[model samples]
Target: MKVFDKYILKSFLEPFLATFFVVLFVLVMQSLWLAFDEIAGKGIDIFFILKFLVYLALMLTPTALPIGILLSSIMALGNLSENYEMAAIKSAGISLKRVIRPLIFLILFISALNFVFLNNIYPWATLKQKNLYLNMKKKKPALALVPGAFNTDIPGYSIKFEEKYGEEDNLLKNVQIADLSQSKGKIKVITAQKGIISTEEGSKYMTLTLENGNYYEEHINKSMQPKDRAKMPASKATFKTYTINIDISSFNDDDKLDDEKIKEHHGMLSIVQLDSISKVNKIKYDEYTKNQADYFFNILEAKKLYKYPDSLIDTKLDSVILNNFTTYNKSIVLNESIQLLKRTIDHNKNQKISFKDKRKLLNLYDHEIYYRISFSLACLVLFFIGAPLGSIIRKGGFGLPMIMAIIIFVIYFFISKLGGNLSEESAISALFGSWLSTLILLPFGILLTRRATQGMGIFNIDSVLDNIQKLFNKTGNKTTNL
Candidate 1:
């Protein structure tokens, strides 16, 4: 029995490793291609390049694990079926169920690993990836600009250098900078024959190492026509060692996260934790709670605007309806104080409304907040579906199962993305939006595996089509007989 278990385990390991490698390669290759120009052109080191790919691979592993399992399981089982190994075991009085037990245990172990990944490692990796992007964005453009090229990405500036040296890091000769930094927004064209980039206080600034550099700058709001502005333009400064601060733009808006925990809290926290923080820390929960609250507020707000009585003079009717709306809306939303701020912004945008009324409406948005927590936990739900599915759909190899896994996983990914968005905008219940993809795919996987194990055949899309054809033929024959 131990030998049988070992054999079963061995049957899966080869395919499992193969699928994992393929998936990792696919992920790293895609990201490397996307970042190729930046890495190669910008003189980025291999260490940084490797770190970027590693973070990306980590983020993608959870997304790819299910597909790996599906493909690997299919390859392993299909190989077994092709060799008549299953038949032999059956002849020896061993059920297919018993033969597959060790393999299922292996899958269970993998599922546990996936659970840890989804909850902890994945979130950390993705967050790191975001931060990396942010740091790149805030880094100096001059450092990234290729010598002898028209570099225009810098803020309110442009540069072109005559030469580059040291392969990656060297000074530029005959450098020209179009600096538009005056009250009149004039352009200062500075030409330096020789210059070197130096780093000080953790910031990069260009230091003109030689004299003989002509300087042209534009003054802001100069009383001159277009041609006159060019000739008699703004204040231009020239110096041999004019050290200027490198333009460092702030991080990208999405990446400028103040709270790492909030961004990552999605894949963490149990239902009880969700309820606990949501219940206790009304103020502290605002960062994460906003999404769920949006769900409830959206629904309640819809009810208020669209659910008005048909008759305008129906004061009694309006009074009761408005009261109901107010009550329900207030129950689920964040602090009503934020409502006052909303009303102010709305009023400024030519939208006249009562702060009292708007705040009352906005008070009911908490339902949407809790919905995201529900969605994050559904990763476990997907694992359950992915497992038995791969087992039942034992095809020739990874080819068929891989396709199926991609289709299913993409659908799952898309549905959650859509639901999470709609939930934020109040198009669906928070719980429903978060759990929508899982719920939809759960029954589908269940139905598919259920049919497979019941002698209906695994992934028998062929038999299904064949049966439909036969049924049509039968109906045609019956009509002819009639």
Candidate 2:
């Protein structure tokens, strides 16, 4: 290697390593903070917490790499320019492009590494982190319950409460429970005016104490006729105070938690998996759309409605088809037609909601496929932007370069999030949404590189001012002549 190439590589590497770890640490901490509620006071082991952090860091490494490259490139080049080393190299006939050539190759290699992380390591980490979190929640299922939503962390039970408040957050208001433990599709529902929850450490049971409640159990009898099903026997009991002990042995069993159960989430899939699933989903989606269209067509009976007999081909028909019927029959037919139309409209409305949900799911898969590719190239894209920007600004150290990096990265992140949201809603194509930020910044990077190489300022403020003055002068002259 040439001495200059080695020197430049060495300079870039120092800040790159420093910034990469710094960014990774910040991201991991941010994730931990967001999940603090789920982990705090849950009696989870310290080692388990550490393992979660490790998985989180692995999952976020690809995101941190690009930011590190951007900041390091800016600081490295900015330092060289600020210290007059860039000028000395230029005086020695070394072009700006040649100075950055080694860094360019390094960034390309980093980009490929980022791709590997995103395609392989990221999915693995996501799967581990998700399952590990679920296991943690299972360990203390009561603490994981949030008011106003059904909590199914407990097996065979769906629990919800209107409010959870008290010194230890163990008090519940308007508690509702759905028991699904029976083998023969039997259902039991319990509602309480107020309830208290208590669990002991290392215990296999959690007790719920209800103050004022009612229990309703439905008796299932498949042998009964359909007409009698609605009137099937049921049992209801009211109590001033009731206590129930729930067996939580399954929650303590880590061996029962299967990691394979959660591999279908978009974050847990690789590029190949995403592509394959997307293709299958697209086929199913198309088939579903076609089937719906066919079903509605059949319901409308359009073919029958438009059909005419050969004898009636040349005859003038009444404007209303019911005109040939007697008054009583016409009214009856009109009422039936109105009722059918109402049912069709209601069915269409329901189908529309289902279609929208399926479309959004497919959009998520499509976005992930393109996002992996685009995000992997961020290192290269950001290097071009940051390196030239550093040369043009001619500032070194963390003050100005750090601020600039933050501003640029914030803009990029905002655009990416916005595009993803729009794409998910089907307002924009997934390909366009995934690449929007990169496309917006690429030209700016090229412009900065051009100006830096040509020894010009970031923008020609003097020329813009001159044009404004010239426009004013022309306007003044025209007014005077009038």
Candidate 3:
């Protein structure tokens, strides 16, 4: 029995590691392509880029784990069944369940490790990755400039270039700039046949030296007088060389903003921190509901405090009182009632908005908490599904197993994402939304496992089609008799 367990585990480990790294690499490359726009041509440090890649890989671990486990389990068990090892074990009086017992224990351990990653490592990686990306954006503002596009990184200025060259990217050809710093109604345009850009170390300014350029300054409606504006002529100058200096010191500052100032993003908090936040948000939500209820009660009491006879307070307005009251008195009463109702409406509207915001925050915390558990358990759920499905299929190797794993995972991913969106919108309770995918996968895993143990294939298209045809023939015979 010990030797059998070891052999089964060994088979699982080989494909498990291979599938994990392959899936991880593919996911990382996908993420890199998505972020290429932000990182390319940015002149960012190589070390920073490496950090970005590492954190991104870490973030993708949870997403990759379930699929890897599913593929590996399917391949391992299918290989054993294909080679007739499983048949030998069953013939020797060992049940299929008994054969899988050792692997189940191993899967449970991996599930626990996945939870550790989610609770500690995942959150840390999420935080560092976000902050580092923001720092990179700040450190390389010049990367925003692309040839043939109007670059607006500089305040009150827009620059365009037909072409740019050189290792330092200092040479600019056919440069055009529009300056709008001085007056809103005036325009200043500068064009150069060729230009060079330079920045001084530890300086707050960047200089643009242009050769063979023209400058145009035009003022529309000068002096705010129609006649004077028409007479005031536009100024134009042609020059062989010109220079412009702009401030860019903000890009050089290495002082990254403190994470504390951002008030701790929910995605970046650990299990302990999430628990504390959920509790706090719950208290706040309860308080908001209580205060809103009390507010309405007070408004109703205030409306009653107005001096009115019991006779005048009928559910239906009293016709006698309405007829007896003078026009002036009637007008005064109507105005007072209208003012009170308007105030009540305003208060209700404000309270509704406030309560809604608090409840949304509470829902976020709840979703996060449940998400940690559900995603962690997904590993074990997928394992049961994969191992049984492989045995039933009796197909081994990456080709067929990869397709099966991907189809199952895609369904899981789509359902989980939909549930998350619904929970975030408060359309469903956080607990239900977060656990929906796990609940769906659990029964599927159980069904597959049962079929495998019973020596029945889960998918038998030909058998199903033949059964349908037989039913149709019976229906045809009944129709003929009628």
- TM-score to true structure, per model: 0.60, 0.76, 0.79
Clashing residue pairs in candidate 2 (N, C-alpha, C atoms within 3 angstroms): none
lDDT of each residue in 1-482, candidate 3, tens digit only: 69988998998999999999999999999988988787676566577778888999999998899999999999998998999988898899988898889889988988899999999889888888888777665455553568999987777688999999989989999999999777554378999999999988877888999999999987674346656666666889999999999887665454452232333778788878998999987887788788877877887885676676565456677688679989999899999999999999987787778777777788888899899899989999999999999998888999999999999999999989888889978999899999989999899999999999988888778899999999999999999999
* Cα distance off (Å), candidate 3, residue 452: 1.1
> Candidate 2 — which residues are off by over 4 angstroms?
141-260, 308-327
Q: Kindly list the per-residue Cα lDDT of model 2 for residues 1-482, writing each as its tens digit.
A: 99999999998999999999999999999999998887676656577788899999999999999999999999999999999999999999999999999999999999999999999999999998998887776565334778999987777788999999999999999999988776434368999999999999978899999989999987876466668767878899998988888887765654444444677999999999999999999999999999998998899886887575654577766657656689999789899999999999999899999999999999999999999999989899899999999998899898999899999999989999998999999999999999999999889889888888898888889999999999999999999999
* Whole-model lDDT per candidate: 0.61, 0.89, 0.86
- Can you write out model 1's per-residue Cα lDDT over 1-482, one digit (the tens) per residue? 59999998888788878888898789779877876555343434455556677888987786666666666666676677667776676678886567667866676667667666755676677676666644543443334657878777666667789886655465777888776544345356778887676555434344335446777655534566776654554555667665556544331222332224334243334344445544554454454357545654774575686677657566434476656666557654555657855764664454223323333223223332444344444444544455445545545575676787677668877987787767655577666776787778778766755664454564578988999999999999999999
> Candidate 2, after superposition: displacement of residue 309 in Å?
11
Candidate achieving the largest lDDT: 2
Q: What is the RMSD, in Å, between candidate 1 and the native fold over all Cα? A: 10.8
lDDT of residue 176 for candidate 1: 80
- Over 4 Å off, model 1: 31-45, 142-207, 211-277, 280-394, 418-428, 443-454, 458-482
Candidate numbers, best TM-score first, in rank order: 3, 2, 1
Q: After superposition, how far is residue 283 of candidate 3 from its true place, in Å?
A: 1.5
Error of 1 at 113 (Å): 2.9
Index of the highest-TM-score prediction: 3
